[model samples]
Target: MDTTVAADHAKLAEELPLDQIDVSDPALYQQDVWRPYFRRLRRDAPVHYCAESPVGPFWSITKHKDIVDVEVNHRVFSSSSTLGGIVLRDRPADLELPMFIAMDPPKHEAQRKVVQPIVSPENLDNLKDLIRGRIRTTLDSLPIGETFDWVDRVSIELTAQMLATLFDFPFEDRRKLSFWSDASTALPYAGTIVESEEQREEIFRECLGYFMTLWNERVNAEPRPDLISMLAHGEATRTMSPREFLGNILLLIVGGNDTTRNSMSGGVLFLSQNPEEFAKLRARPELVDSMVPEIIRYQTPIAYMRRTALEDAEIGGKTIRKSEKVAMWYISGNRDEDAIEEPDRFLIDRPRPRQHLSFGFGIHRCVGKHLAEMQLKLLWEDILRRGWTIEVLGEPKRVFSSFIHGFTEMRVRISEPR
Candidate 1:
């Protein structure tokens, strides 16, 4: 081997421990133990490889610039159906349901256009009042001076309702949709994977079966405002088979549900830790608009997204071979020294908050980005306006998955209504 190849092997050996980096613990996720490791990778091995069980080894892309390059140049580094899924590890055959998030362009663009308008700014503007009302009702229902699970009460409730409204699904069963989405993204150590997978398929069938019934009823019916109605009646740019429709619906639910849930939980945690910042927002509620993005930056709910190389390519002076998997650590990228000033600290009024990659970058970026922001802003505004005091009663529990980093349980005490 050449001298350069020897050095690359040495570097890879040194960074082999990244394969053991477990994100299942809340403390590890909160304190961010991976930041230092990512910083080293960004400095020495921007395109380092690691070997692991189940799925073997894959390259780790830590630098913000490199991540953007791979994300933007989807032609070379594609999200195709044949190259496995978009996740770091290969999913079980039973649970392998492909969505647009894992598809390359032409097809991806065709499917994306179907639901894009429903989540656009104009449509979101129409939803502001309804969202605000839901927020108000959620806060009002919280028991005063008693500890309760904030994750379930606040985050899940809000996002679940938003999703239910988006799909025109029965409001009462919205939580079931959230449950299935959460299960579909289970991590290696999240022991509930097997059970969750079984349950997910059942829930999906139930939900999709109902939607199909609705589709039949609405096939010849007038165009309704909900996403399902639009998708059912829209031009057939890409035909959505029953399986594909269920997969995409499940994708939207998981995408819209978990990230926003984590952001809401993270927002409350930030407020509890930074009382001064909370007070600043309470004093001037208009700041909630900008504060939403700051919370996303600070918490980075969706920690990382994995992509596979379709062909051999060079990034940040390193060559990635074809069929190699690459994990984009968004949590570390958001706090990249080159990306933002005082990246560690939570600053509500930070200028250029949208610069954060929390919603990701390029064509594969989140379609519900605007909707998530509106929900966060409205929730914060509602909490402040209602004169609520959110006290952290205990330590927050983190999810076991690296893909969707969020709270499983957050005990909190809400003060009485003033």
Candidate 2:
């Protein structure tokens, strides 16, 4: 974003009537000027309502405490796909699919349990060396003193590799995992992967067809630890419908890809912007323990998770009626002053760094969070060991979406290994 545009957004956020201020505009996130708008909402109306947006009318839960209240009270606030699913925009009936994340209690728990073993402590311990080896290879292959996109070269590559391993996906076709993941969440915007909803569905059909082939093979064979096999063999997921199968596949792909990939890219950008923190990390490498969660908090990979009100509920002294949509702005909540100290600054060694809502809370909390953290810890540890100095070459080109708060490109150059 340029100086003029940023100034204009700041001005609009400050002077616009409270009801007219719509933080749902994708432009605010694309230009990386969302802080002012969210700051205004958090300060004045933590449970603010927008009567209009490109999507539709919805209530914004901006504060830390308020967002948690909504997340925990799942009975009142439903994540059911039949009630428009977990994103602010309602998908067309044909587009809607019954993923576990978008389901309510008993069903959600049963389906979620099917894949829980993939990230179990023993499994992660088994996968550690493989993750570290991949990270080392990726870092070692970067061109010294030459500018490159860290998002593609490092972040996407590493996460795609890991996602492939988790699914036991064909090693040669790993990039397809990322392409499908991007297509799954992509909206019809300029520079977006899919041109229209029809096109997006076309891509999903291809994904479903490919995965169904794998599912057939896995289902017929003896059980194994891969996600597809686990789903095929597990009692809860074995009887899933085709659409439900596709939905769960997309859910796992997006959950695995977006959270870790975006945060990896964001960490590089954050450290570049905060050189003093980078110096702190270099001087005391042990700070990586604290720095990992701090990165997730500061980056806030997925911006918000939407839930439909199952019944009238009071939050922040306001009544939200049944069927009204509410956006739990994790991005805003992570920076709430009442929750986090010096919310704007990127602190590498902050105490209680994991208090933020990046991985969410309550029963719907991220299942793969420990795996994500381990990947980050291993990657940063390898960088420190390599003694490589990474220099940011330009401002990151952010994803043009309100939902997925992420980067598309981040140019950087690595110094010669010390």
Candidate 3:
């Protein structure tokens, strides 16, 4: 965390007010020293307000219970794009793209149901064999005893393959999905990913053009099992406008890519950092079941989800006025001591590990939650079954976004295959 960019932007003096703290600073997360920052908030001011910052003023809800309260009460805090959608940065009014997750119920529920069957129990059962096969194929292809970017070789590859399967996207061109997902969330200030807003929008436009080709094809084809087909044929979603469909396509792509990929990449790095935990897992391989959820909790892929106050509401003793942007910092809540005992440490086996907010909660609680978990569970199951262990060769290059909390590259080597 040497001279981190976040600390510089969020310059604070000893006497500075807590409202001056801006957790939306991407550098804090990029440097991975946001623990103390969030810890300070949870201890001193659970529902603190930042009067102003790069992404604008918003109340930072750091407590787990408080975030859950806001999530469950969607009426008071709307997930509508007319307000601000989910992220702290409000969408441009002129270019507003409406996705089902960003919409309230009735319409939201209607659109979400079309894709729900794709990740349902039966669909996961259908996807399990495909996911496991990809995991096996991907791991076996890694070079033995050679340093490589785990995020590229394993994380992105596996997740992108799944995304391609979901949208029935072209396998060779599947990397485009990851590219668009990255571009969608990369803030203009985050120099590491997309350099500017123009660049981001250009990538997004390209993404829409490519997906529109598939949308046209899917609309004519007989109903299939993939997401695009589900949306094309489903009663509620089939009538969506082009931009609305593009919005949902981007949503599914990002949702499918970020969380599981980061957890996959992060889990390997975690074991390397905690060798004893690695040994413990090797000794008790069944812990992968527990470890999967713990990894999701630990990494907390999407850092925060924003909601606009629909009415005057009180939370954590703060009176949030109507139409004010309120950000539920899921990353902070996942690490809140009140929520999880020994929140700092990454313990593979923990009681009620799934209680964390990695997949979020309420109506917008990740439609692909089951699919993401299956991808991870099958991954570790394969790793443990083969008695292989990966060792981190260098520190990870994290994604430069407070929103999509994840890795871009992680150097590692296959250390043992006994």
Candidate 4:
């Protein structure tokens, strides 16, 4: 961000009335100027309320400890899809998709357990060689000395392949995984990837139909290690309705694709912008161990997680009434100064890099976190070994969403060939 523009934002943030501060605008994230607004919110009102917005009324929890308090008290802060799922915007009544993440209590636990083995320490160990081989092949194929989209060629492709592997989906059709994941989270605004809810529903039906074929094939077969097979054979998930099945499939797809993919693009961008940190990392390749989590904390792929208050609750001394929405802004919490030292700096060598809220907290904490970390750790390790000089040509085209904080395009070039 330009110094003058940043100053202007800070000025506006201070001048704006407390009631007029709405951080829910997708533009704030798309333009990459959300810092000042969030900084003001953290300082002034950690549990701030916006009574009106495009996404409707909601409260924002900006501080780290406050966000964690909401996360741990999932009973009070309900994630029920009926109340309004995990995003600030409520899905249209007819199009509601009830996945386990949006369910409360025993149901959430039962369904979550069905897919837990996919990221088991044993499964992750089994996947190491496969993941590394794919990473090697993808890295080796980058166009030397030419500018290209890191998001498409590297980030999306790599994670798509991983998602395909996890679900045992058709490898040749792997790009569909990313396409459907995008559609699943896209805001139905004019000129956006998804233009309307009807279009989104059409895309959802297509995704569900494709996955249903695999489900039928797997459900009748012997149990296997793949996610589809696991779900098909697991007592809790085997009899899920078509909509519930689709919902879980979309959840796994987004969970698998976004976190690792965006972090991959973010690592390259962050390192390019901070040459000193990049130089230090290059000098000590072992720093990849800590750098991986730092990338996640800084990028914060999924910006916020929404939960509705089941009853009156106190957070940061504010009362949240029954059935009202609350957004735990992980992006803001990760940058909370009280929780993280030098919160805004992209420091890879922080003593406790993994303590951030990118993967969230409590039972709803990302089940694939270790897998995401392993993917990043392996990619960075390989990048160091290959010695390619990557440079970001310009600012990335960010996703037009406050929910999925990611890049749509990040142009980069290998300035020096390996």
Candidate 5:
């Protein structure tokens, strides 16, 4: 362990609420319990190390500028297939999928291009009506003055339906797709359910089987404008082998599922917590455009992403050696006071809110960012127009994973539309 990491850890143990700092527990992430500790880290040790983990010791890169530098310079800090995927912790071989998000340049660029057109701004605009309809239907389904799990009814449903439309999959079974995606991504944190390699392989095989069925059906059917068909019949350079295709499917499922779902739940929670901001949106719904980025900044659905140092590099005045894992704490960076004024307050009209690190930075920045924003904006618009006061009925439950930070269950009551 680096001397800095040792010293920082010792300080953290003494000054911080070390016992409550369990990154694996979703509840901790939801209540924003890590904020104070991260604030301490930012002030004390910007580039620190965690000398222990399920995946062994790793460095925690918690500053805004430092994370941007690592994200932009992909050559120095690679998201390669060999050095384990973007998550700080490594998974068992059987559960690993060769997704582009986990790949470095050339290959990552090639694979990314396959689905890039589908998520482009123009394509997203084209889907606006379809998206609005989905949101309206979802909001309508919630009976007036009823309490329900917001995570299940709103967040999961909206994203799943949008994903179903995007992939040209059967909308009726879209929830199953969300389930598989969650299971796949959460396998690393699954204690008894996915106890061993065999269990993990079984779950993945089941997911792959369903995807294979969809792939074969789409490959034979008439080409539609959906992502699957686009990849099926797009330019030669965009074509992918079955393995790569499966990898991309898994990537889409995981990427599309958690981030937006968490953001939806987080957005609602943020509004409920910050009633003033909610009232601001209620007044000027047009701010939904700017509000989307602010919500992302406040929620920060994905807590951190990992990168392996390909060579010796200096970040934030700290030396990182070759092959060392550097965890970019997006949660911490988004709240860096130097980057945004009044970083702790949730301001809907925060100018240049997109500058936050929620969606990441540079080349590997989230490709589905536009789509995520679109969905969030549409959902908020629908909620506001319905004139429903969202009340938190119970404490939200978060997913037990360090990789994807999100809510698993959040109960809320909606008042009758005025």
Candidate 6:
């Protein structure tokens, strides 16, 4: 670290006390040492403030109940794009893609309803066979005795395939969905995924152009069950502007891919780290139903969501000013003991597994929550049925982003343990 930057961090930590804690640093997450930092905040300052950081000044809502309070009270804690959108960082002005998750009430509902049916329970049931088949083929292809990147072979591939199916995109080029999701959320300066903001925008334009061709086709043809067709024909979304259309498409693609992909990889890593939990799961494969939420809870993809205050409000003894950015740290809250029993443990068959805040709460909760859960449930059920086992071989390389809580690489072997 630069001397000035290090000195500055120290100065802030001293002067601001616990208020100076900035959990948004990507390095904190990448190193997998963020637990202690959040523990400090939850114990001393559940609604603490950091006057400055890479993303800028913001409040960290660390405890579970406090985060849910921010999520439910939408009127006071606005998620409007006009304020700042959902991430801890502000969306680029020149490239603001106004998706509904960032908007409030009626507009959010109207736009969301347009494409919501694609992942409805009935549709999910219809798609189960296909998802299971794909998962089986991908797992069966792995070499049993040799190590391979579980992320590339299984995690990314399954999620990307599902996303391609959702968008009805060409299956051969499906990895492009994962590529686009990474480029869209990653910062160029972060040195993690994309190199620069201009390059990132260029990739996004290509994504939009590809989708536009599909949009033109869908509008001219008969209605279909695919997402593009639904958006092209739905009364609420058919007349959307190019920016709005791009926003919605990006939202669906990223929302549909990243969470499940990481959670799949996270599940293996967590189990390997907690062998007793794995024993419990393996002993009773039927526990797959309960295991799904525990995996999501332990992984906690998309760590923190940001909301801008519409008015002054008091939370945890601190007063938040209007227009201030307040982050609901779902990752921290999921591990908050006040909201869960032994929040740090990785038990697979906990009685109240879903009690954690992974899918979030209230209106803005993840739209694909059910689908993501189903994917994990089915993945585990298939793994157990085949009597297959995986051994984590080495330290996992985590995604270098505070927002996308996931793995970039994890070496694993599919053979039986010695």
Candidate 6 lDDT by residue in tens digits, 1-418: 2456545544544454675578998986776767777877888788889898988999999999899889999999988887789887786787677888889998988888988899899999999999999988988888988999999999999999999999999999999999999888886775556887778778888998999999999999999999999999999899999888988999999899888999999999888888887788888888888888999999998898889999999988899999999999989999998989998888888899889777879998888999999999889888877766688986788878889898889999886545
lDDT of 4 by residue, 258-288 (tens): 9999999999999999999988998998899
lDDT at 11, model 1: 61
Reference-based TM-score of each model: 0.89, 0.98, 0.95, 0.98, 0.90, 0.94
> In model 4, what lDDT does residue 49 have?
94
lDDT of 1 at 251: 82
lDDT of 3 by residue, 6-118 (tens): 46533542235676678888877888867767877898899988888977888999999999999999988999987778888876787787999899988999999999988
lDDT of model number 4: 0.93
Alpha-carbon RMSD, each predicted model: 6.1, 1.0, 2.3, 1.0, 4.8, 3.6
Q: How do the residues 1-418 of candidate 1 rate in per-residue lDDT, one tens digit apiece?
A: 1345546544643565654543323344543344555666666666677765445677777777778888899888877655766777676665567788888888888788888988878898899999998988888888889999999998999899998999888898888777777766764344564354556577678777977887777667898887777778767423578877777877888888987999999999999989999889878888888899999888888877778887899987778888888778788788788878888788898888888888889999999998888888888877887788899876687776556777888999988455
Backbone clashes in model 3, listed as residue pairs:
86-306
In model 5, how large is the Cα lDDT of residue 352? 87
Question: How many residue pairs clash in all the candidates, one count each?
Answer: 0, 0, 1, 0, 0, 0
**lDDT per model vs. reference:** 0.78, 0.93, 0.87, 0.93, 0.79, 0.87
Best model number under lDDT: 4
Q: Of models 2 and 3, which has the larger lDDT?
A: 2
Error of 2 at 86 (Å): 0.8
